[model samples]
Every structure is written in structure tokens, then in C-alpha cells.
Target: MSTDNTSLHLEKVVPEAEDFLPILGTDFVELYVGNAKQAAYYYQHAWGFQPVAYAGLETGKKDSVSYVLQQGKIRVVLTSPLEKDGEINAHINKHGDGVKFVALWVDDARKSYEETTKRGAKSYVEPYELEDENGKAVISGIHTYGETIHLFVERGEYEGPFLPGYRVYDTKAKSPDTGLKFIDHMVGNVGWNEMNKWVEFYGKVMGFAQLVSFDDKDISTDYTALMSKVMSNGNGRIKFPINEPAEGKKKSQIEEYIDFYNGAGVQHIALATDNIIETVTQLRDRGVEFLYVPETYYDDLLDRVGEIDEDLEPLKELGVLVDRDDEGYLLQIFTKPVLDRPTMFFEIIQRKGAQSFGKGNFKALFEAIEREQDLRGTLN
Candidate 1:
């Protein structure tokens, strides 16, 4: 399904959902880059994504080419400049190829635009209609962190692979999916002292509520620390956690990302999976390098998270971390940076019954990040 012209085929995750923004889940994540063709290849080869849709000069788009790839319920749009000196090229120059658009699917783009802009969102793209033979799609957008945007997409009756002017990607090659279901949550890293401003932005402008919050005291290692607050929309279908660095003995992981990324931007996307071991196994075999904790982290795993369904040996072997709250347990692992900059990675998450965002694993996870930073010589 597309956040552009996508019709999500899955049932609502939240039943009897509270209807604030009335989101239909993530339609797609669009990234602006240097080479969309190569970016598409990397996602296909490394992450088991199949090419689903495409648009470019062949389709009368004179400025950019976009490749839409999908796996399970997840979709990603990779776009690059068809000509130099455009906004896409300038974006790549400033951010070094990261997420640009975190699109949301709505029933009425015009109303979505009016609702947020009236609530004080900086307007990016005015609500407009794009039409082709299949049907019409309405879309609008507003600015967010860095150069990122939230596109309100209304597909209405459109029923093609994606948006107008894009044809279904025809190919002989396809990679097996790694049990990834959908985007669980996307995390954003903000500049120093800037977390609450954006947090309030979502709460005030988009009607999102703060779900859970973590302070540096709750999420720090000896070397670094960060604070995060999870913000969820009315229906709980969309979640964004904003993070800012706290003073630490060394350059914390968030600071390193900010430094190398040159500004605040998306840090990671946590993808929900039906089977973490199987998904991670496939990703590992296919060349996904994950952050690893010491074998000793598993020594006290049972005592910490109580009993989990997964066998301990496999959990330890894969370097997957486990956490449990009153609700249930969750298995998750983090991939190393997916971009040249030390930004933009993926989190493979399998939530058994836990709605919590792996708070128990933060220490081990951040420590592992510091270890990686030490190797990169970026740690202060």
C-alpha cells in the first residue's frame, strides 16, 4: 500500500480506535538521495524488497525518478535528481541521503491540511489533486524536523500500484521477505535542547499525545545518555519518538548522529516483524550487520524479562535483546547505519504482546552504539 496512492490492505491494529487524525497507517516512506537506481538495488538485495512501482522521465516527471519497493505491508520510495541543482540534489548535499517524507494516509487531504495548518503547522505543499485513468489522489504536506515533511495522502478511489503517472514495476527478480509486517515506529533525533519544541509540535498541531517518556537517568550508559518521549496519534496507528542528547562523559550516540548527519534528522525506523529470529536470520544471511551486546547480557535475561517464548540459546546466538513489561515480552535487534552518514538504520522488532517500546533494552543498546562510535573515532 502507498502513503501516496496506497490502500493499506491490513486491518486496523487498534480496534475501536480513537479517531483524532483518523490515520490509515503509514502509506510509505520517501527518501531523497543521490542515485535512486542504486538505492533501490540496495534495498532489494539487502532487505528482501521487491520493486513495486516507478516514475521518471518515462512518465513525464522531469525533475526526479522514484522507485517504490515493498515487503509485506511495508513500502519505501527512493527518489533522486534527474537533473542537478534541484531541491532533491540540494537535500542530498545537506543531509547525505536520509528520509525526507514520512507520509500518512488519510481519507481527506484537504481536511487534513486545514486541520494541522489551522493548528499552526508550517505549510509545505498545499492540498492538491493528481489524477490518472485509474482515479484521483489528493495530497498535502507540512514541514517537520530538519527538511523532513509529513505528506497527508488521500487515495480516494485510485487503485493502481502507487500514485498517478507511476507504472507497476515489472521484474524477474524478487527477494524473500524477512517476516517484516509494517513500520512499528520511526524515531527522530533532534538538536540539543530541541526535543520538547517538536514534541509540542506534534501534540498541538497534529493531535498526537505523548504515550511514554524516558529521561537520561532511565536510558544512559557510563559514556552517553539521551531522552525520548513517544508521541502517538489519536488512533495509535502512527508513533514517533523524539530524542535529544543529554550531557554525558563522551559524545553520546544521538550526538554522533547529529554531528555526522550535520543536523537533526531521522535516526531509525523500527519495523514490526511476525518472526524476529527468522527475520533477523534472513537479514543476517543476506548481509545485515546488527549491533551486538556482550554474551553476558543474556546471562541474566531470564531473571530480567522473566520467561519468553524464544529459546535462550538462539536469542543469545543472534545477539537479539529481550524485554518484558506487565503486558508481555518483545524481541528486537538494531541494524548498523544504512547510510554513509551515521544515521538512518532499521530496528527489527517482534512484539509478542507488549505495547511498550523496549525500554528495558535501552542500556544494552546504547552501550553497543557507544562501542561502534569508539571504533569510528567519533566518541569524545
Candidate 2:
């Protein structure tokens, strides 16, 4: 874990403006699952992700099953265990369905781990080297809230398709690329009154500073309410939004997450794409189900946001939402809750140049989510 002093140093460096944030790009997202094979197939067929690598019993790995999938520059790894009672099983059982690892690219894994750990971060995995015919890869991990973790990856020293024993599958059956090129942000839900604790934890331990904050008033509906705060690393390569439930007439999304997941953990991963219409169309045709908004909502989009560069007809046809900022404009859409637990889902985002989250679409988006909540009988 990073120490308090390191947190102070980071606070001094990060600027309030978005332009000052330094983030290279996403590395890979790894999820702990109950069944890696089935999950991988669902992602490939439904979300347009292509199978890239695999590891398990066949590869002499006895404890776990891992499958790697890619679409454009985005890579996701799904991991499950061969047996029960292990850490993987424990994590799945406790968190229901959530991300286990957010791998970050770094020039040196050992140094990153040491620097962060010495500063006060909780050590999940010590820096270790793994080698095979493909060469060597160094990795280390640090614990975060619930079962989620951040892994430091130093792959410059290694030359491999993914890791040892995995051969790249060159298949022409690619899922049409959804304009998404990389991860934009990952949101997590925590328990009531725990928002500030996590904010401080991320700030103190991981060299992250609070970027934005929203209370119940900013993200509340007639039936539900929740508070949120966004945290970013020095290079903005990592963005985590922490949410907590607030008093409401009915169960807030954050409360529902706690109930289904059995605790706080990841809520959704927002992925950035270049063309949302094309990507969402491919995903829908491939079997991915997205959250639906009412057609009436689109009736006033043009007047609300003025004239956007893209034709509004295509976006409305695909159920996409648009939001603009002084910097630029962006198109976005969300998937229906993917897991049985209503724990983790995904966001498909296309940013023309804007860096802010889709604030303008919050009302329509929340209304869409409320529609789902009503269907699931989770709405109060």
C-alpha cells in the first residue's frame, strides 16, 4: 500500500483541470468468474470481443482457468478456478460478480510495487517474475476495496503473444469493432457512510486525488439516491468512481449492488470507442442486450444539445445518447446488467474530444436504469 506521505506528494502534483491529467491507455481488464469458458463465449458472441489466448488444465495450470479476449486495443481476461475453497472462489462468493484485477502498464513492476507499498498500500502480490519459452514477465498486485485489485505489469522484458503456452488464434471472425479503443473509467459502489473512507484510502494509498464529487442531489431520482466521487491517478490512466447509497423512497442503485453482490465492488467499466453507432449495432446483432431508454427521450435531443456533428437519426436508431462539453462532444450507451447479480455491466463510450463523463445524459440514463429496476422488481 502507498504511505500517507506519498498521498500528500500526489495531491500536490495533480491539477484540477482535465487537460493536466496524464494517462497513456488501458492495459487489460481481468474479471474473476464462476466459469471462465462460458463467460468468455458470452463476451465474444454478445459484446464483439474476440478470443485471443487461453490457459488452464491443458496448459498445466491446475488451480484456475483464464481466457483472454480482445477488440481493437481493449483486452479483457476472465479467470475462474478449477476447484472451490481457494482465493478465487472466495472472491466470487463474496463479491458475487466483479472485477478482480485492473492491470496497469508500468516500466518497472518491482519499483512500482515497492514505492507504493512503502508509502502505505496493502500488498496483495509481491513482485514476481514468470518465464517460459516466450521470455519473462514481471507482475505485482495491491488490494483495493472488496475483492478488486490493481496489478502492476512490466511486460517490456517479455516477448510473448500473451503469456507462456498460449498461441495467438488468427481467426477472421472478428466482432465488428465498437468504436471503443480503451477503458475510460471504472465505477464502484460502496456501503453507506463509507464513501469518504474509500476516497481517503485511494488518495492516501495509490497516489490518487479526487477529481470530482457528487452528492445525492446531483444523482438522485424521485425513488432513489446515491453519492459519488471520482478519483484519478497521477497519469489519469486509472479512474475509479466510488459510490454510496443515500436515503431514498426505494433502493438506490448502490444499495441494490450491495444486496446482490453481498458487498461493495465494481459497478461498471466504461469503454471508449470511436464510433458508438457501429459498435453498438454489432454488439446488439451479436446478442448483447443494452439498457433501453424511451423513444420520447430522443424527441428533444436535438433541441437540448443543439446540432451535433453526427446524424441524430442513427444514434436514436441505435439507442445511443449524446452529451457535449466546452471541450468537445461524446456519444455513449450502457448495457443491461450483464451478471445475474446485477453487479457488473459495461458502458460503450465514443468521445470526439471531451474528457468529462456524460453529465447531460444523466437524467435519461437514470430513467433507463429505473426502467430496468422496475422490471427486476428492485424498484421501491
Candidate 3:
């Protein structure tokens, strides 16, 4: 655990890069699951996401069904195959309910596709228009690290529940809103030496700039270690931190995720909140399990991160970790794997003024993750 700097904050000097494929923001994230209905219910009841739309057999889609849920600006589309065999079914069978598409809201889908494909991206879906009574929306896609895709959605004229095929879906069941404001960042885990490969892809293919990076020396525990690099788009609305396993005495979390997911894929989604204490409390009460942090970690919290606004007891009780950067501080906590395979999970974050990810908290955070891996019998 190296805490050399008195402040222990990682200062960023991100170089500005010219973005060819201009993205407005994240459109939505779609996950291929075994059961869309049950997954939607779990998200609604457990995570306080409100149902927004639906598309299925009754809506004239026979092969698959989808349910869209939203909380703040974050929209999650859960899709399941209705038939016995298809691409969606194949994805569910292989990845076990993980992120399939990370859609970006763009101004022009065709140009976005053209730019990326010309820059060496493999085309998954060509630009196509989907129109209904509402209007028209254009969508295109390109392959990324693993089975995951970056879907470009140009929905400037379309106005419906979600895309053109979905209709307003309401169950009449009240699910209170958790304070999740928007997606802070989404992290992807790659294989043993593939981090730089994808990092270069983002930089060269997508025109994203490197914000910050970490080696094993900055993010290692006694048992395990990993390396990460944060890449952000031109406007900074989108950020992706790519991670890969590093050599250590035992298997690291990145290695564990790759083993379980069977390839490189999204490891976690970090949702931002204005008040982490309140948001985490609601999540815990609603049956979301967070990683446990020992009480001793909070004894010197004030000294490590400097003064924060929230009460120390509440943060310690909730097992939320605090860290500071050159700009400011942030409060964050990691939930245990939301799935059975221990491949994907969620991170609740509240940025006070910090633009940097919690670099100061990496050691303690990875140690907590190692504890979980030990219980799962994967910490070799």
C-alpha cells in the first residue's frame, strides 16, 4: 500500500485530442439476459429504475423481447431471446447476462460508422433507419474489445418511448427513485496484455484521449494486482477505463472476470449520485450487497482524504470509500457481483469536485475485492 503523497491525489494533465466521431453522450446500454422480464423486475425493485418502454411479440417482434428502464439520464435495455436459437440466445449462453451494446448518442450515424470503420474498426451493423408513427432514427455499430459493440444512435427526429419499435411500458407498480444521476464511467476488463491494444483502439479509432493510467505498482495488494488506463472522449461526457490483469502471487480480479465472462467485457458501471450515503443506504435496504470494508479503514480516513462533508460514521457504516484528487474528493462503494458468475457489478459514486477516479483508494479497494475472491475460492 503506497501512500507516498501527503494528499495522495493523482493530478491529471489530459491532452486534448480532435474527435472525428463526435458523440453527444451515452444513449443507452443494452444487456442480453436469460430473462428480460425478471431482470427488469430486479432492476426496478432492487435498484429503483423505472420502466420506460417494451418491445416484444405483442408489439410484433417475434424473435426477441426487450424492456427499457431509466433512472435519471441512465437508460438500461434488457433483452432476451424469445426463440430457442438466435444471436441474443448465443450471447446469453456465452456471457451470462452482461453488457452487449454500449450505445453512444451521435449526430450522424452514417458518418460515425464511416469514420470508425475507415480507422480499422470492424463493422457489426451498417447504418440503418428505423421509423414508426413517431419518426425515424438511424443506428450503426462497430465491434470493440470482445463481443461488446459500440452502437451509434442518431435519434434527432424520432420521438417514442425508446427507439421506434418500443411502446410506453408501465406496470403501475411504484418504484421510488434512487438518487442515481447518470453514468459516471463504465470500466472494461481485457485479457492479460490487451489493455494497451484497446487503449490504442480508443485513441486511434475513436479519437479519445488518455486521461490517466495506473500500473501494478499503483494498484496492487499483497495477493493480487491489475493495471488500468482511463480514456475519455473530446467533450469528456464519455469515459472508459480499460483494465488488464498483472502478475501477482494470486489470481487478480481482472483475471477472474475474464475467466468467468469467457472474454473481455464490461466489468462494472459506475453510477453517479449527489449524495452517496443516501443512495447506498437505499440500495442496501433494497437487497443490494456491497463489499465490506473494515472499520479500521475509516480510522484514518480524514487524514488520508482530508476533510469531507459527510459524517464519518455513516460512510464507515455503509462501507463507502473516500478519496481525493487535485480537483476535489469523491465518495464511492462497490457492490458485489450482481450476477451469479461474479463477472459484472455496479459502483455507486459521488464526486464532490474530483474529476479523477479514486486512485488513492485503489489498494484498500482491491484488498476488499480479494477478500470476496477468497470466499468464492478464486483467490489462488
**What RMSD does each model have against the real structure?**
2.4, 5.0, 6.6
lDDT for 331 (candidate 2): 87
Q: What is the lDDT of residue 53 in candidate 3?
A: 91
Could you tell me the lDDT of residue 329 within candidate 1? Answer: 90
Model 2: per-residue Cα lDDT over 1-380, one tens digit each = 00011111123334642322222445678988898888887877677777788888888889998888887667898999998698889988887656888887666778878877886779999999888887887888888777678888777656666765665644565555555577888998889899998888777666678888888778877888888899987666678999999898988778888898888788999988777888888888877889887788789888877778888788888889888878888889999888888778899998887777777887778778888988889987
- Scored by lDDT, the top model is 3
Clashing pairs in 3: none
Off by over 4 Å in 2: 1-24, 165-176
lDDT (Cα, tens digit) per residue for candidate 3, span 199-294:
999999999999999999999988899999999987787899999999999999999999889999999999999999999999999999999999
Q: Residue 187 CA error for candidate 3 (Å)? A: 0.5
Model 3 TM-score, all chains together? 0.96
Per-residue CA lDDT of model 1 for 1-380, tens digit only, reads 53344444444444432344668778889999889999898889889888999999988889899999998778899999988797888888888999999999898889989988998999999999888988888999999998889999898779888988899886787777677888999999999999999998988888788888999999998989999999887667799999999999999989988887889888999999888999899999999899987999998899999988889998888999999888899999999998878888999999998999988899999989988888889988
Clashes of each: 2, 14, 0
Listed in order, each prediction's TM-score against the native is: 0.95, 0.90, 0.96
Q: After superposition, how far is residue 258 of candidate 3 from its true place, in Å?
A: 0.7
